[model samples]
Target: MSDKINWEYIKEFNDSIRTIWMPFGLPEIIDPSHSRFSNGVDIQPAWKIPPKIAISTTITGAMFSSRGNPNHPMTLEEISKSAREACEAGSPIVHIHVRDENGYNVLDPEKFHKVIDPLKRDFPDTVFDGCMCALDSAEWPHMESFLKEGLLEVTPINTVAVLYGDTLFAKPPYSMIEKTKICQDCGVKPQIAIYTDADVDNADRFLIKPGLLQKPYHWIILAAVPGCSPMQNPRQMVEGLMRTYNNIMDIDDTASVMVCAAGRASSYLATFAMLMGLHIRVGMEDTVWKWPHKDDKIVNNAEHFKLFKTMAGMLGREVMTPDEYRRMIGLPVRKK
Candidate 1:
């Protein structure tokens, strides 16, 4: 009895396995009605929307300087020129991190105005947003002034503290809430910067669930940045992004997710986001290299936009226009 095989038990087990594996029975064609077709009563799923991607170019950020790229825009004129080039390359959203005469990232209203005012005059339909600068109290006044002057149409609010090397970029719950209120009060849209999944939870608990952040929430899922939540492995980074995105969608189904990175992996992450019907942000702020493994540097923000446009074309997705992006993100289209 111990040596003999139990053929009856083996057959039963095999049948059970097959039943579990093929619950619906071997890929038979189903009725169109049984498909995800919108019935008369139920709302159509968001995936039904055609593939259109908003390309947001971060013209400059805390990373790049004269040290990284000799042509990295440091002056007002240079920054303005870079931003204009980005728009010409079909980026509807231009993200700025205004640098002073010394190239240090600052949130000065006047400094920002110098770069933005001219761009606004030229690309009236383009949306402008900027880095909030480490979530410091001293920076809030400048940010508020910038918003009040209508220089910025969108701004980021980091949800948690992140260590970019030894420096801690802190965003306490109280400060983040305050920042959200400021954005709301100033009529500027706030996009939450998520460095990790914890940041997403923090955003939900502090900004979202409390009714501070309303429907159709916007998010920037940041990854591959050093000293924060770096996912250097491509597979892990994609999986991490998927999880982070799912976490956000779990909380708010209507939330718009954008993917970005701080290294050579930026382009890949952006591509993945586009394939998933999400948005993308790319520029010198995220990466200076044209390719992940190559040393070929991106000479300007326009280059990033051009490459992103080509990728979008290859993916069968349209690059969204400035006014189209504005409407999608709930911003008013600017009049020329």
Candidate 2:
């Protein structure tokens, strides 16, 4: 049998267990056991280059209870303070989510400016990445403004339409294509968020093939969230990364892959991703639990980054600097 991965089989496996995401379209249930590539020939870790980790300091989350962490930042000053701490603790890239005075998640560019301006000034080398969340066609201009104003240098493009409770948006094939154009026009790099392997295929066929999305292809793979693609364990994380690597290898082998997850699973999955020479994302946005269990206290963003840094060092994996990370993702150097 050929050692090459069968992309068609992997896509079929993703569809086999696909379930409806309530009010939104179907998102696959990722059980690696079901993937044809799961039990195949072992793929070695990519160690020629060092590892990197991004911090997603999600000030608030879907549950609305500070993700069970009372210390989670809910105001601009608190968020700003957390960002500074995270940067000092060794996080090169920060994925941010801003909140208004009322503690509600808002995509207002002015509010974003309040958070980003001081951050860019304080930590000039830190890479700032964020999401516009669910936006309608009318809100497209606001997104464009965010990019033009230098509020967000890296933006996330969720590969599929998502709906969680009241949060809903359609990221259909056409919308993804349009978003790619927007990223290209604004001179911002798109970090494609993959919930399943099919998302990777769509990105390759619709964006890469058309010359809309460029290299080095950056991706954030979400693992194991209820009502979405599940990849909360080592096996699942390996499966997800393997599928992504196989798909992107066809387009560009130098792509960057970072993994994050919900709740306690976030830490576990991220650790495994590190062992494989893949990057990781940490912070309250992904999980508040300090350990890979629910009994732990809800740690802040800095605490999260410190833990990941310690673990990476223990494993002898050198964490990349902000400039190193910027180079890996093809980001231009910012003036200090």
Candidate 3:
């Protein structure tokens, strides 16, 4: 009830804020032994292998509405055709999302087989990975059936909850452990989909330390998704990616990190990741737009793959073949 303002308290608060804003000088040369900063130009690790970029294509994602491309693949036959084209275009890894007759994403093993069986027959060298509804109760059963049938070489286990539009994709710690155990038992690999920095810490603590996840870990750093921690801003997207990448490398330096985005920034981020010696995931599943600023819609999965390949060529990086990718990721070659 005093008329006078709290000048002393305000001064104290301003001083604390100034202290928080004080910048510290950084050394001219960062230590090469630093966990996150170990990968530098001069002190490149002798064990580092030659650069061979691996491309993973997501033919169809659950969120795409097929807006401009009415001919977008929805049925099993159409999906198979799209995936085949992608493999033919030099993308060895295909990330799949199977849909029902009504075009709804479902965890049905039979539907997945209908799409995967034909591709497996035709492209034995191609590696297949897929997305699943983490909240579905039948996730495990469907995954088990898929593994038994050899329908997938990799399966995704989201490390944290995220909002995809209005829907919340939740990943309980117990569910993640169970999924990892199933993958380990089946000799299949788990692609950790990281939506935030916390996802990395949780993966290291709940999955890695517990021995549920094994070495040569494969991670997909998801960026620019609608309601995730990373936003659509370019600065935010890159910062989030670098932070997550460093954190993952801290836990497992040999791990394979792949970059993927859910918006127009997909192409830019994928290129940045490729140049940084990381893998990339592209196609309609990640974005409908061909570029960040343009409204151009991606014609097909093959088109996107070809564009990426051209960019890789310009960067002087060779896109790995299916067999080469398999060897790099520690998967046995399907073709003799």
Clashes of each: 0, 1, 0
- Between candidates 1 and 3, which one is better according to TM-score? 1
Deviation of model 3 at 125, angstroms: 0.7
Model 1 C-alpha lDDT per residue in residues 185-242, reported as the tens digit of each score: 8888889999878899999899888898865688998777766566676887688888
lDDT string for model 3 (1-81, tens) is: 675988778777764555444223245344444434434545535444346888889988887755635646777778888
| Cα RMSD for candidates in order | 6.4, 15.8, 10.4
Top-down lDDT ranking: 1, 3, 2
Question: Highest TM-score, which number?
Answer: 1
**Candidate with the larger lDDT of 2 and 3:** 3
The regions of model 3 sitting more than 4 angstroms off are 1-50, 68-71
Which residue pairs in model 2 clash with each other?
224-231
**Candidate 2 global CA lDDT score:** 0.70
TM-score for all models, in order of appearance: 0.83, 0.77, 0.82
Winner on TM-score between 1 and 2 is 1
Total backbone clashes of candidate 1, pairs 3 or more residues apart or in separate chains: 0
Candidate 2 segments whose C-alpha is farther than 4 A from its true place: 1-64, 162-169, 232-234
Question: Model 3 reaches what TM-score against the true structure?
Answer: 0.82
